[model samples]
Target: MPDYKAPLRDMRFLIDHVFDFHGHYAGLGATDASPDMVGAILEEGAKFCENVLSPLNRSGDEEGCHFDNGVVTTPKGFKEAFAQYVEGGWHGVAADPAYGGQGLPSSLGLVLSEMIGSSNTSWGMYPGLTHGAMSAIHAHGSQAQKDTYLTKLTAGQWTGTMCLTEAHCGTDLGIIKTRAVPQANGSYALTGSKIFISAGEHDMSENIIHLVLAKLPDAPAGTKGISLFIVPKFLPESGERNGVSCGSIEHKMGIKASATCVLNFDGAEGYLIGEANKGLNCMFTMMNHARLGTGMQGLCNGEASFQGAVKYANDRLQMRSLTGPKAPDKAADPIIVHPDVRRMLLTMKAFNEGNRALAYFTAQLLDTAHLSADPDQRQEAEDLLAFLTPICKAFMTETGLEVTNHGMQVFGGHGFIREWGMEQLVRDCRIAPIYEGTNGIQALDLLGRKVLGSQGKLLRGFTKIVHKFCAANAEHPQLKVQVAKLNQLNQQWGELTAKVGMAAMKNPDEVGAAALDYLMYSGYIILGYLWLRMALVAQAQIDNGSGDPDYARGKLATCEFYFKRLLPRTATHRAAVEAGSECLMSLPAELFAL
Candidate 1:
């Protein structure tokens, strides 16, 4: 396994030059987030990820987590690594200062998350889950509730988990069998078995805070009746075991080091977080966080795999270039000399860089949504976020899977072996698209609800962004080609939506049939806009004779590659979406079983 090094250069480029995060922070009233301070934080964070976490990727997978007698212990070095993480205050970078957090921008925290995720995603899950739980508490928990849970969670003395999935229900929260009966003391007694709970029951934290969903005794049926609860593994005041226990840990493929526990809550004393039956609303707060984080996991896996592939391709001598010998000094030539290898490498490069831009851009939107004092600004940012979240989650992960497969293919047979670490990336990333509301579901959310539900209003918010960008760069000599493509795609997006909307009116199945393809189409254009933005920035740097020449040139090259090679795939998705529901729905339930 190649040692993971944080792509600080690219991260810095996006923060400092591409996005002007410094200006963004000042606008948001985060005066303390100076360039020097954030730089130091990234520097220190990179060290923590590179030295502390990267080494654990393979070891953690091999050791996995242990389960015995209702206790779950993480892999070796995980406990100590977590303690060091807490001591360093990395857990509270983006948390509120009112709750003992550092009061920095959430965007900065996302930067750290990318490093942690790329280094060791399994190790990242513990703190990742805690942050999600903390976000829920900070948003909706009562004053006393915040005082009790937020501070501890912000400080990383306690960990948290979102308990939603069950044996019978993964996406359908309406079918949840968990029950919460009201006790006279304003609390509830919860009894349910939740499966696929990551970091659910672990020994690293003093106490585990579970933000659980269940049906109240007198509530209505289905999702409308669901409610959120704060269930702890141990009573906070008494330090005694609560009714919650780990029935067993799932023996799974990949992410083996992260505990995926089947938690059994037998009449566990749980406190209601928000109004009864509004749990789904509050749960979205946590789910949104995990969804975006899952998207980053996709970026991480693709990045790590790309790094390995590039290194191997440059060193593994195979055949000579078709034209001539590129590396005449070597035995034959490094496999990188091959055209197909370059295609794969460039594809990974294009997505890895394009996705990074999207992630950080979305991060900036997150800051605007949370920190802006202006109401309209906040709402606009939030709306854009609501529109982009599903796209980012599904599109990035799907591309990540593709990138990793390409990465593995570069290695020939060695990719299948554990020692190479390429296969681990594929196995680990396989879960991202499955969990986090599966990519298929994400597609529906984008097409059915966000786009069509609003009559293209939500989508226009994003396309208008591309609209302005294309308008601004319309005259650039080198970029006009891409700018024109973006302009056409931007217009095509709305027209396509209108067409799908018309079809869906008559046959609702058209929405489902067109969704996944629609989402992918949207993703390519979204990424196209981002790549163009990078190209413009990089071209300006090259023209001015400023910045690192190699970096700038590489950015320009990849941007061109994406436009030429990758962006055309959007057309296929467009055709698929416009094909309508007939071909798909015409197939009866009782198909030809010949």
Candidate 2:
């Protein structure tokens, strides 16, 4: 296995050049966070992830988690490793300062997340869930709620879980049957069974907070009546727990050390998160954050798999090259000498780098949207961020699975075996596209809510930014052609958006059927644009001699690969989107036999 190393140089290039993160941080009122400070923080975070958490990854997968009745235990060494993780103060890197948090810019925290996730995704889930829960509480919780749970969650003394899915209802919140009854003491009695709850029941923390979605007795029907509640395992006076318990833990395909539990809230004590019957709104706060993190998981796993494949390709001696002996003294040439091997490696590199840029760019936009002094600038940032979120989650995860599979293919038979850790990467990444609202759901949100509902305003705003980048860099010989390609794609996207919007008005199923492919097509164009921007940034840095020449050269090479090889997929996605709903919904119910 390759030694995990954080791509700090690449991260810095994105932050400093592509996003101008320092300026954004200052805009966010993070006056203390200079470039040097950010670099130092990233370095420490990288060291912690590489040295403390990464080594546990293989062992965690191999050992998995153990469940005994109602108690769930993580793999060996995870407890100590998690303690180290919390001790490093990483749990609150981007959390609010008012609640034992460092209040760092989310852009910096995003880079740290990639590193930690690349190092050990399974272990990463423990803190990952905590952050999501913390965000929900901070955004919607009352002052007392914040004072009680926020600080403890930030400190990593207690873990958190989001309980939205039941066995019957995953994406359709309207079908959820969990009931929350008002109690005499201002708390509610929650009784329901929730499944697929990550970090729901774990021994790592003294208490586990569950942000559950249920319904009130008098609530109207469907999603309009849903509500959010905070139920804790033990009743906490100060920072203690409430009466929440884990019914059992789930046995999953990968991420073995992360406890996925079946939680049973049997008359459990609970408090409302925000206004009654507005749980879906409050839950979206957490879901959106989790969606981004899940995307990072995909990016991180893809990078990890790529790193392993690269090492294996460079070190493993195989048949000699067709041209000549690249290593005449050795038994055979390295596998990297083969074009097919290079193809797989380059493909993985292209998607990993592209997704990295997209994730960081989105995070930067999030920070700007939150902290910009001008309301107009903030609204613009928010709009673009909303438009990109679904792409970040759906497109990135979809490609992440593809890249991981490519990495596994590079390993041949060894990839399938559990010993080399390639198979686990595939399994772990598979869930990202499925969970977090599923890629299908994300697609619907992108088209139905973001594009069609917003009347293409947000999409147009984003394309304008791309156009401006292209116009400013028109002199760059290498990137000029790629920028032109993006311009063409942007035009097509606009036309397609109009067509889909018009068609959907007549036939709603058309939107449902084409939504997924449209989201993917848009994502490809957006990521392709991002890759070009990153390459341009790297080229500028190289000319200025500010960073390593090899790093810049690598960036340029990956950008080339993305344009030449990966960008072509937009054509197929466009075709699929244009196919409309006929093929999908053409079949009648009686066509199938019982």
Candidate 3:
């Protein structure tokens, strides 16, 4: 396995130069997160991840989680590492101060998450799910519920999980068989089994809080009847074990260290959260957070694989360079000298860096949405978030998967070996595109609900921002051609949406058929825009003789590579979208096999 170094130099570049995060923090009223504090946090967070978490990654995977009976014990050093994580106060860096948190901006928390995930994704799951639960309770839980759960969670005294998937249902929550019956005490008794519950049962935290979905007896049918519940492994007041138990943990292909449990809640006491029969609405608060975090998993695995691949590429000598031997004294040139190897490396670099930019930009929007005191500003931020969230979740993961695959290929046969740890990244990343509402679901949500559902208002919310950006930078000296290309693609994006919208109005299947392709197309454009943004800043630094010119040049070069190579993917997706639904729908379901 490659040594996981937190990419602090690139992180600093994005935070300090590209995004101007200090100005952003000031505007968001996060005065506590000043330049010095942010700097200190980044350095400290990097050290903790590299020195503490990274080392345990391979070992954790090797030992996996041990489940005997109902108890799930994490791999060696996991419990200790988690304890160190909590002691360092990393759990609540972005939580509300009123709830025993440091109350920094959400973006900072996400930055830390990138490191945690890259270093030890399995361990990160313990807190990743907890943070999502915190968001849900903080947003929709009752005051009493908040007081009971949020404080302990923020203090890392307890951990949490979002339990929605059942054997019968995954994305379709309308048919969930879980039942929540009313009790005299105003609480409900929840009874059902949830599958694929990450951190559902663990020894790392004292208690496990599950925000579950179930149906009440008096509730209506389908989704309208669904309700959210707070089902803890142990009753908070009594400290007695609740009826919830881990029936078993999954023996999975990857993330073996993270306990993926099959939880059985047998008449467990649960408190209703938000309005009755409105559970899905409330759970979305947590799901969205998890979706973004899942997207980061792509970047996380990609980064780890890239680090390993790059190191191996630099060290592994193959045939001589096409023109001449770059290393005459060393038998043959390194694989890094090969064009195909460079292609893979550069592809990883472009996607990783561009995706980071997108993640940070979206994180900034999260800060705006959460911290802005002005209602209108908050609403605008919320709209942008709604539009971007699916793209962030779906697109980043897709590109991230591609990046990891390329990284593996760069290692040739060694990449496929278990000892190198590259294959583990591939397995770990495979789950990302499948979960957080499969990339297909995310695409439908993006094209069907978020875009056309809003009559393009939501889509406009983002494209307009890109418009202003392109208009402002239309005549750059070094990057003018790329800017023009981005501008044209931006215009084409709107036109493509209009085309799909018109077709979907006549046939709703058009939306489903075009959604995945449309989303991929949208992703390429968004990344293109971000690449341009970073390139513009990099070129400015180069022009004015400020910052590291070498770093700036690398940014510009990567941006060029993105435009010339990856951005062209938009054409293929666009073509598929224009191909329409007939080709997909013409064949009967039974004909698929035949």
**Per-residue CA lDDT of candidate 2, range 153-190, in tens?**
99998888899999998998998999999999899999
Clashing pairs in 1: none
Instruction: Report backbone clashes per prediction.
Output: 0, 8, 0
Candidate 2: which pairs clash? 233-242, 233-244, 234-241, 234-242, 235-241, 235-242, 236-240, 236-241
lDDT of 1 by residue, 411-507 (tens): 9999988999999999889899999799999999988889899888899999999999999999998889889999999999999999999999999
Against the reference, the lDDT scores of all candidates come to: 0.93, 0.88, 0.93
Cα lDDT for residue 135, candidate 3:
98
lDDT of 1 at 37: 93
The lowest-lDDT stretch of 10 consecutive residues in candidate 3 is 470-479
Global Cα lDDT for candidate 2: 0.88
Worst 10 residues of 1 by lDDT: 585-594
- For candidate 1, the TM-score is 0.99
TM-score, each model? Answer: 0.99, 0.97, 0.99
Q: In model 1, which runs have C-alpha deviations exceeding 4 angstroms?
A: none
Residue 172, model 1: lDDT of 93
